[model samples]
Target: MTALQRIEQGSALQQTDDADLVARIDMLNAIGIALSSENDMPHLLERILIGAKQITRADAGTLYTINDQQKLNFEIVQTTSLGIKRGGSSARPVQLEPISLYRGNGSPNNKLVVTYCALNNKTVNLPDVYKENDTGFDFSGPRLFDKKMNYRTRSMLCVPMINHDGKTIGVIQLINKKSINGPVAFDDDDIHLLQSLASQAAIALTNKRLIDDLKALFDSFIKTIAASIDETSAHTGEHCRRVPYLTLALADAASRDQKCMKDFILNKQQRYNLEVASWLHDCGKLATPIHIVDKSTKLETVFDRIELIDTRFEVLKRDANIARLEALLEAGHDKDRIELIEKQYREEIKQLTDQRDTIRQCNIGAESMPPELKERIKQIAARTWRNCDDELVPFFSEDEINNLLIPYGTLNADERKIINDHIVVTNKMLASMQFPDEMASVPEYAGGHHERMDGKGYPLGLTREQMSVPARVMAIADVFEALTSWDRPYKKAKKLSEALAILGKMKQRNHIDPDLFDLFIRDKVYLPYAREFMDPELIDIDEPSEIPGYPFDMP
Candidate 1:
């Protein structure tokens, strides 16, 4: 019989005589719900193909999704009679060439059965492919398979999986519907059932692809922000990349800790969220001024103001020389008096030179500056010097004096506040965003990294009890990265031993999370990280036993 005649007969049989029709309808509804609930792409595609085969009792089927090149890309293929499965979750991959939906000249490719279904957005039922010759599609693929497998090319059903927008996204093809007797033509009842299932599959696939695209876009956005922040300082850029690695590594280690298994272990979503938080922790630094961040010396602003102070010292030397010359000219008639005046002038110039050297030394930042030295800065500031207006003024301005008197680090109090305010800005920026439920803790974890265990840290003085484990994980990562980092403007990278010692001290003083620090040492997370990212010379062979407060005996 012709393909059309067979379809008409199947439709008549479907309406009047099928006792199992109600059961099939219920099965179709259940399959649709199952397909809709599947979120995994490979599993979903596999389920779609499997569902169509079971409903039609087909011996074989192939699921194909359209690619950007307008080709029918085989996503899943299964053959029950041959025990063949490829693609989707199968160990074997689909090696078949994608069927083109458009030829080189861009005309519709209607010669292939799958392409024909996708192009026309309609189902094709062939009762017997070997006997049919009137259909516009080529059956060479199935004919070749039959020849190779010693199988017969018989009944077929090809349905277009169309999305809600009425666009064909893919095609579902079933071959050789099997019955108790042998291969039989897929009837209109089977055709209608497969089409309904294909429709649900298309919507599910579309929604999944859309969600995947959005996730990809969101990841790119985060990376772009990180790159932008990194571009602001060549020194800080490496920190942005390395800290995330360390954060995730430490987190993974913590997750494996048997003592705190319940508290520390992370699910896949939680791990992802922690990783995202680590990458974004320093995003607030984007708001901090580059000059302050790169300030290598105490007197630095746009440029070091120390040079301006040096010019004033030179002016004082010149004034002293003029006075000495004037005295020499006046005392020319008195030799002994002239000698005394010259000696006094030389001594006065020597004092000014000493003071100038002291100020220059003070300009360099150190771990600590003494009170005595700070008082001398005030003394130096009081020394009189003539301005362009000829009015005498203090040798150093109030702001310059304050910068020079900074007891620790390059930044003065106001500049330090500006730098610290980045955390505040970071909190605000992340808090304002609406994250998915899986990532809702991103703001909290990222914002609390700077907070100390003893409530001594900035932006918010959140104590250990208030902070989450992930937040504490970030805090340790941030501290360690900064300590061993060679990219800072003012300080050299600390050796592994030195960095760990400082961290140990911080733990002893309640400056960081002690339990996490112990795990960091016991787990040996630092060694591998240091080998990868630290300068070779800085990677020392200090044992965890030697690190103070590391609790080497802890189980």
Candidate 2:
């Protein structure tokens, strides 16, 4: 061979190596972009290991992450030659136990190559595991694994994934570097490339974990607020908790409804936003007065005022008895006159007792207050009684009379307004928050639960067209949860049939979203929700047709 020919051959090999280096650099750039974008932890971990294998031409690889217990857990495992795949989106589980970072004596366990790489935050490259004895890493586990699978363990490379903080979070180990001829040792280029890849992987992983931890903290904080609101009033019970469950369930059903909800589909981020909105729907109730929230009776404030009214009635009876006694003394033993005075006193006492009983019943705040009953309350209010200061006052105070005449439920008009204002406050509170773009609609969704479909709802009075689907879905969820909640002080929990019937009427009256309500019944979204949250005794409905708004006739 001529000297010129040999020089040309060397030049050709150098060019090929340069081209390969350029290609590998481009691949690394692409892999970095992918690792940064991947949100799923498992998929991200798998991608890191796979990308390292592709760059080094490795035949098999395993990825391990350090857990809180100071142990290495297998996150992703792949062996191309054996056709073995486990973990990281694969249905097959990684059945191996974790490798503890420390021994029982509290010393670092640096015997295993992966752990050694992790513990030392260093890269380990082995030309041949069977022949390499100076590095002092135990190869018995790999040898046993290879023997069990009838495969050879050779040409290994392990890299520590060090984050920006200089902490080794995990390790990536590659086995059997592949070549056109057969297995070959990983060289300096492979080690450098893998070390760079490991750094990028670590950063991506740390960022993802940090974001996940922040989200978890935010979620727990939101739930804690909801729980605190529930704890503020015994009457509210689990309304805050159950509404989110039903809201998500109904939203899921709507999303799956291809016919009606083609445009109503929610992606993962949208669903999460809706979940946040649902969790914070009643957050404004936190500002509500506890007396109104826990108003078990019409006369309920800090305490029931009926006892005060009862005492006033007793004073009136005492005055009537005093009048009868003075009249009898003035009669001077006229028998017929005495009998008539005694009759008048007895009749007066009975009437006072009946009026007191009537006031007591009125304070209970039944579903409806009859006009006659209201008039009776006014008549009782007109009667006079002397106070402890010896001044005559009306039998009932004006406030007492107003409370007793409440047309329906425990709350009077003012208290009802206060209760309804919670949604307004919720809007204000959520609006004050600096949410991300994805969650910008939270205030609207949470605040719109009280809105009517026909633009009759409070605060903003958004019509069906003005509101989003999530808001409408929340309206139905809120109403249904309230109707079926057993802990409400004013009313008994309605049976499933009764609640559905009322919901049907609401749909017909344009009080709630018509399509969502129909979807709710048709898809039987309430069944699982009822089973999970509703009282067992309240779940009495047997058929969809029995539900008031069910549009379909099941065969």
Candidate 3:
């Protein structure tokens, strides 16, 4: 055969016919599509390096990415012959020093071949680095590496990965082409194929990085909004922070359960979805008024109206004293008559003091006010007193009457409705955001946390079957945080036992998820959660049986 024919036929051991060449090109095209579709940076980078090595049959390879500091970072390295690997799928980091693209004087670094290729946007095809003298690039580092690792330093093909804007983002370095007989130098075909792969890889990497940057920006925006909401109420800021953690913890526990692992297991994207949802669960509270949110007593509005009531009681006492003195004056100099009038005056004062004390006690709104207390409030409200208008009027106005008549908590019905409207606002606010496919369920999951399992929840009356596990988990987290929280103005932080008992009762009444509650108790999700977020004093230990509805034995 002629010498030309022999060369055109390619190497005898690694023969490449027209058909084989076409098949490899087709495979390269398929790999390019796959690379572009990969969203993960680490995996995409690993795939790029591995794909280059596979196509060229290189025994060793290294991938470098250019950093903002004008340095080439060693991202992935692989040497198959010695079973040496670092970074990427090896789960180990590459410890090699970075190559700087510029020197201290701000001159382009052209000594190292990788840095030179990246600086010039050129491809370096060195058949044998030890014998190369054409480019005047340094090979001392490779020689030292070969000596230290006891490896041969032969052919090298370095290709610059250029993005759409003709900027070099990285370099792909391939070492020693392997064959059945011995190591072979890289040829023109290898160089051309690798360059094409490098181009596709550059675009893919650039796209993935862009996506990552955008995701980071979006998350920052979400957190900023959540932080603003938290800032609106001092008491709820920590609550906002704690619920996400508890949600993740309980969700993770549920994911590990053997009984329903298939149904509950979360992928990386789904976990992120749930986490973002948990953080934004109570964002609707931002629209609520601070006065209603911080109302600590029934008569509180700018300040406690109970103070004004006390002033009125003082006026009544003053009037009683004046009437007693006038009656004594009318009795003239009769000592027995004066003593009787004075005795009656003392009784009147005692009764007035008792009524003042009763009204003060009713204003506190600490516990549930009984029917008789409410009725007594109405009767006391009916008693006439002279006002600044110089007309006899009821001691308590109608509005005050309504406020003091609140059967439970500090807020009246209207204020409670205002508080509940926040969830509706939250649903509306999140619904307007254009979430990506991976996080599409964020709104639904976050919005449903306030909904009841029995269809009694406000805004949207969703039933148990209508809610997702993540949403249900969020509900539990929200309730648990509120129950154990000491910062709220309306209620004291319950002990761990008390909180669990309330949760148990909620489970029994279908206010929360029963199966999830059982799993929560069984897996002891609350203990670790309390340790992380709850006060040490609030973590009171108790038996599962003593908790109102905790299931002792796991099914």
Which candidate has the highest lDDT of all?
Answer: 2
TM-score of every candidate: 0.89, 0.96, 0.91
* Local distance difference test scores for all models: 0.88, 0.91, 0.86
Per-residue C-alpha lDDT of model 3 across residues 44-162, encoded as one tens digit per residue: 98999988998888999999999999999999999999888888767788998898999999999999899999999999888888889777888898999899999997889999999
lDDT of 3: 0.86
Better lDDT candidate (2, 3): 2
Clash count (model 3, backbone only):
0
Q: Candidate 1's error at 53, in angstroms?
A: 1.9
Candidate 2 regions exceeding 4 Å error are: 328-339, 548-555
Query: Looking at model 2, how many pairs of residues clash?
Result: 0
lDDT of 1 by residue, 73-94 (tens): 9899999998989998998999
Those runs of model 1 whose alpha carbons end farther than 4 Å from true positions after fitting are: 1-19, 147-153, 331-354, 370-372, 542-551
Candidate 1 all-Cα RMSD: 4.6
TM-score of 2: 0.96
